[model samples]
Target: MLRNRLTRISAALCTLAACITFTACTATSEAQRQATASKPPATDCTAWVGADRNAMLPGYLLPRAQGTTGNAKGPTVCVPLLLTANQPPESYAGGDYHISEFTADKLKARWRDCKAEAACFQRVNAQIQRWLPPNKARATRSTGTVDPSGRIDPEGQVDLRKIRRPAFFAKAPYREGIAEAEGRTYTVEFTVPPDAFERIDLKKTAPIKLRGWYLEGTGVDDGKGGKVRALALMAPGGGGQLTAIQHPDEVTLRTDAKTGKTESLKFPNATTETMGQRWWRENLHALNQAGFDVLAYDRRGEGLSGGFSDTNTLEQGEDVFRVLGQLENGRGLRMLTPSGDVLEGNAAAGRLLAGMKANEIPLVLGGYSRGSMSTAWAMTSNYVASCTFDLPEVTCAAPRGLRNIRGAILLSSFASGAGYVGDAPDLADRNLFLGGMAADHHILFYPTSETLAGMHRWPAAFFGKGLWDRAESLEGTVAAYNRIRGVKEIVLARGPHSIETWPESDRRYLRERMVAYAKTVVVGGRTVPGLPRERMWKDFKGLVATTPDSWEPSSRPRTMEKATEQ
Candidate 1:
């Protein structure tokens, strides 16, 4: 019966497509068909388990061979979690895959039916949340002011003119990694110091630190017709320390130039931690080594900073803008027009730096992936010098309001598959298994040099070499920059996706070009230059190992040479 239902859905779609050529209709029909076929038939309860049902089970991974020689295998059974029925409807809408609750009897039933231990275990894997069914309710970026209790308060004023107070400004630390998908949650506990307390009642305070997923719902409507929502933090319930998972330093560097002042915001990847924060830590080093004095912080939900109910790309960009305004050098720069209205700023950093000691400084903004999007959006401010890095995959206002950027240093990055190309030849074959090599820190491709010499500070082991293929192309991102006339250069590098792992030579070359360009155009009153066409490509070729004499290949796991005697 289940199969019949799916077949009927597919047939209906085909018939609908034949009748209407309208894009939306055709698309919707096809989507419906795909959804039905892709999902396990709801009628097949014999092979199905829901999220709540699986949670009662005893494991997280599918059964596998165990012991030194290997306990070879077990029964092979298929247990599919009917996400639509098993998981909560709200969870599906909120981008959460956790089964909200489970009962002990359900676990026993699931286990008894498993053909193999692996099948039972696989049913409960929390990681499956990352692979949610398509067309399901998706989470998008949204923002509202957080209240005195660390709860989201949309009615609060965000006027820059007023000395605003941040609610729940305190520290909460906890164990790094603990697995409890169903009810796992962290409560942020902190206080709003009286001195910093301007608008809110001083006596009120609440939790700030947390990890896991949250949902948004309208409770209090901010007067402007915008409804308020809370980030549904999934916590089993308790008091725990919210340890800083990643602390990103947001540095805005400015150089006095003959023409005026130039400023650059660099977001260095985090370099402090080992296993847990590898992606973030490496990003800090990559941006730092690349010459960006990045403006970054522990994202609201991650580091030691305040907790947020919900955050999206646009919100993050707004936060970046807010930080730039708060800088010492950013005062009185004029964020809006004389007309008193504008999302884009004429001298966003300058206005933020107003009344400060530093004056006439030009600013450059850059970020990695999400951070890069923040940088791109900053270009809309007239005070900034340049905007560069991976193109943000999210929506952002154009760079139209800012001064003509002197240059852009984009890394292995992209926002879509349409324009992206596969890996360059040299980068495609480089060995990624170098034992504890610093190459991991670089995240970008290795230099074409004979050895992995200066690349040691990077952590290359965390990713596979296949990822290099995608990093080589920016998926035709240059077209986006071309829209901003007078933009100096767009330098694309080879290697892994992140720029930090690029060869030192590549790093230095790009930085030299950016600084020189900044000095001439924004400072020296000279024409900004573009990267000489072949510079980026030539560097990519150098990473390839053509002969045995080439740099020693990165190390990898070796198979046992001979069978051990049992």
Candidate 2:
């Protein structure tokens, strides 16, 4: 009987051991399941097949100035690709191609005639090589010097390290090659299915549904013989409302002033061609290549976006708030129209938002001319500060004050409305109020000295010379913002009222300043190099006192009434 009791006790112990093992395994599996559920889904790119050229690739056509003409060219096709961890692909030269007229048509015909996937890929690659060859001259080598103590020397004349063979150059033997195939234009090719090529119609009017992973290289140094890498998935571009969760819900309808009929507003979407052109014009893509996820879009009624182009500050603030909310929550934004139309949100956009949030990317809001006002209003408006958007089963809160914004770039800003928009309030007081509210964020202002000249030549009807002269002087504006800890103003020696029309040197300077400021304030959390900080206000005041009497408004009293009427 004792032997029987021992056997029963041993069996009970074995049973308990098995139960504990099973429980542990079950818990681990459940944890993994939860993690997988929270992760964003992979993007889908099958809808691009048989889509219109514009719908498939928005912003392909260049925006021509009035009365200006160019050689007739065929439709440009831009294929977005996915990038690898390796350096840029062998086919890419970090430049754009303005192919001769009809070159695009021949390329299109070749793409249509190709039967096999490999053949099609080869054809496209060949055309790209023929028309847009890699620019070897533009390729730059990483050059820097190091001291004996292993610290980087900013003033060193010679590079201590002999690795001048391009930092991205792979050393043979240990070098890991780029995976899969390389796109003819960029580093990595989008893993698009072969069959999708046959389905692309190019002539269809419907928008293409394409999504893929894209790696944008930002040539920022890691302070230790390495470069910083940042990636952003490409969003669909064109003249329509954004369906992606990464984008804000766009206002679509507005009453036409002439007919009083509610009509769709058009928004400009950045396409590959236009993106390249913009890179050439504004160096915007260079900013992306420099490590920032640049999201260039037209405000509600501007560009190709469908909506009443209204400049109501409150509505603009609301729109910016929704975008901020989407970025924070990784969710789609719900936009209710004045017509009571509830436009549904997109899941893909939410996934993109989730990815950005997961990466902990910061935002830098920037604008030029009227856009400056929009950005400023967005920062200070009550609507944006307190607004929230309803996601599908979740509530996404808007940014509190300027909490999410790390910096603001106001180029040729009319925030003060001092001399241009009519008998407006003192711009100096308005700037002080807004600047105080965003004390923690960095603000960079680029005011022009040749605004009077620009107004007399091109925009004279809208902007009076007196108004332009006063606003562009930036004396009061600088003094008002000088008290803010992060505020800094740069007076361009001679630049047009329109930032877009500024010379290449001026534009380059602005880009460098912007990048440097972003690096100092956001990445390094330090003071900007070469900036006069508190001393600029006093120095500028002295300069104003010594300036010619002609620059003063009192010297030209006759124009004051005319300026006020505007």
CA RMSD, predictions in order: 23.1, 28.4
Whole-model lDDT, model 1: 0.26
Highest TM-score scorer: 2
In TM-score terms, candidate 1 sits at 0.32
lDDT (C-alpha) at residue 367 in model 1: 41
Q: Model 1 shows how many backbone clashes?
A: 70
Lowest-sum lDDT 10-residue window in model 1: 232-241
Q: Per-residue lDDT tens digits of candidate 1, residues 424-445?
A: 3322211221100111111111
Candidate 2 per-residue C-alpha lDDT over 1-566 given as tens digits, one digit per residue, 9 for 90 to 100? 98875564443333222212333222233323332332222322211101001011111111121111124353211211111111224574321111111111222333344423665545444433321111111111001211112122222221222111111212332121221111211211011111111122112232111111122334355456665432222221112111111011223234444643333333223211111123122333445556654443333332212222223232343455455454345243332222223332452233333255522554555555545555544443321222111111212232243443555555555443222221122232222222211121111111111111111111001110111222333332332233123534343412223332333444565567655555444444445566433213234223222111122111122322221110
